[model samples]
Target: YINDVCRTLREEMKRAGIHAEVHAWQKHLASISRKLEYVPRQSNENPLSQLHDLVSFRILVDTDNECYLALGHIHALWRPKDGRIKDFIATPKLNGYQSLHTTVFCLHDCLAEIQIRTHDMQRTATYGIASFWYLKDRMGKEGSPNSWKLSYKEMVTWIEQLRQWQQELPESADEFVEAFKGDVFQDQIFVFTPKGEVKDLPRGSTPLDMAYRIHTDLGDHCAGARIITNMDESGCLVTRQVPLDYELKGGEIVALLTNPAVHPTRDWLHFARTNAARNKIRRYLKTYERESQQADASAPVPGCQTTTMTIHAQDRPGLFRDLTAIFADGGINIGSVSSTVQERSRAIISLSFHLPPSLKETLRALLHQIQALHEIEHVALEPHDDTF
Candidate 1:
């Protein structure tokens, strides 16, 4: 059954114009035993029949880019089993292994696992970093002439980096092993930027994580992600803004839309996957809170109450006219007004209004009115007493 599946898969690849070498194999008993140890005891199933990779086909391609191109073709050819596809090529194993794996129900109800990788990756999977020494040991090259030896040494350095992560993580041996299986060995999702650059994130990462991975500034200003996905019934591509809590998946192209007035929300900490992303968000929040406190302390004068209202909204010709008219109708005197038009047809307006003792209670209602206006996205009011 495995052989027939491989043959059909190779034929499909040929039809789809994917050039690669495909090798099929059945797992040895010893290898199967080692794998069974990792399986949860709760699964009361036979390890042999349940193991998807027991009967597998490995396809070697030429480049990393071609791996994804081939993956699209393969999915178009076969109906993948639910939750059976894994993309290790984007997020390589801690041991520096990379591949694209998928299990599908092929002919005769046989479940076959297919592993796709580059030729270099296949060598790494076989002998790991020692694969380079294999050529040198046979060819007697001592003059640093073998490029494979140099590449293998580089792989060793990366493996050492993985060891550093293991040391830094606070986990027992069993826990660490489980984490390794989950974070490194499990399937990964790959998202693409507007420029087509691939970002390998954990399976449930949000768009905010992608922004932080790109740059701290971009992440700090990230408003949302415009994701292009195949959601239409006619198989057409649709673009929409992904909610901050949305979990991203593989092969989705995301274009980040940034707004200067937008900042990280507290709930983002719950969804950020990477440590860098979480740290960046925390730092931004801390700095913002500190600045707000300082401004509250120093912005007010003696015997007077002052408040600042920062408004973010869509840019319109009569926006200022409408805002000032509201202030005039409310009998509030604006001390000063500053506004800046930004990219993406947005504007940031900051207003300092003097709060007389009589009108102190109406300040909150005035801010609420501004927030309820059309085109307004956000409104923040800060008031301080100068009686100190």
Candidate 2:
């Protein structure tokens, strides 16, 4: 039945002067078994009846526009099954599969599935993102024109997005398997950045997840979300605050607001859905709390007249030169310097300075200045234990 549909489709496309290669296949038994796990147990129902793509036909073309053109011609020839059409080319799958799928009744009233995609898309569908290598091999062997080459730029972008998804995936075997099925294999929702770039995220992802996907620092400093509703008649954007726990929907443009003075809190972990966002929040909170504890332990006690400032950074030529200059500008004289640069370009420097009672209030501003210096990773101030 599907073979006849494929023949008819090829003949119709040929008549229309649309060049395409059509292929047909049945679903593998292993794939059917894996799908059976999800289907509910029915006493009288045949398991095969539940599968939609028992026999499928694929149409391959040369360009994205040709995919739609093929789809339109296929629809014109066959009466499509109501509500059985899906445009995966416009919105690709989570794994970057791009094809237009439709199930139609054809050839003695048997249902058959048809997929339309470009030649490059067919290669990607067959080989996943590794199709670039396959296409390259073909180009090398056949000396194909540059136009025949599959663009690696889109493949690279998908690889980056997959990497971000992997970071947030579950670690344990059972949890990882479940997350793979639920997150990676399922249909995804699309959201937009402020610049109108589309981002595919798992369903139920929140604003914090979007921020973390963009950058760790952005997630750490995320204060709120601005949901772009639409443009006003005056051409200004109308936006509303989307709460931290709000589930994002498709096509909504989200703008993440960041506050430099704010650091991530442990409470953020509870609301964060993605592993990437939660892990980053926890890491930042751990570092922040540790630094706070260190500061408390190093606070100046009564009768302490000296202070020690610890600086950590990546070592470079003349990196510490600016530190001495900053001290001179602040009118603080360094009494002692203990410093070391590790093999991996990591530097730790401890500087001791005499602190008078009158200058105690001004010390915080000086410490802030040191922290803001380029190449400095961390700055912590403590009372010098040894009396000067």
Best prediction by lDDT = 1
State the lDDT at 84 in candidate 2: 63
Model 2 residue 51 CA deviation (Å) reads 13
Once superposed on the true structure, which residue ranges of model 2 sit more than 4 Å away at CA? 1-96, 99-118, 126-136, 145-150, 153-187, 229-238, 299-388
lDDT of 2 at 173: 50
Q: Could you list the CA RMSD of all candidates, in the order they appear?
A: 14.6, 13.7
Q: Clashing pairs in model 1?
A: none
Native-vs-model 1 lDDT? 0.72
Model 2 C-alpha lDDT per residue in residues 1-388, reported as the tens digit of each score: 6666878988988987889999998899898889888887789998777677888898888776677667667755665664466656544666777777777667776778888888777777878767757777778798966545444544455455555456655354544345445555545565667775656666678888888877887887788798964343232446889777787765467888888986777777777876556666766787888888766544554654777889999887876898888878876677789999888889999998777676665676677777888788987778543222
Worst ten in a row by lDDT for model 1:
145-154
TM-score list, all predictions: 0.60, 0.46
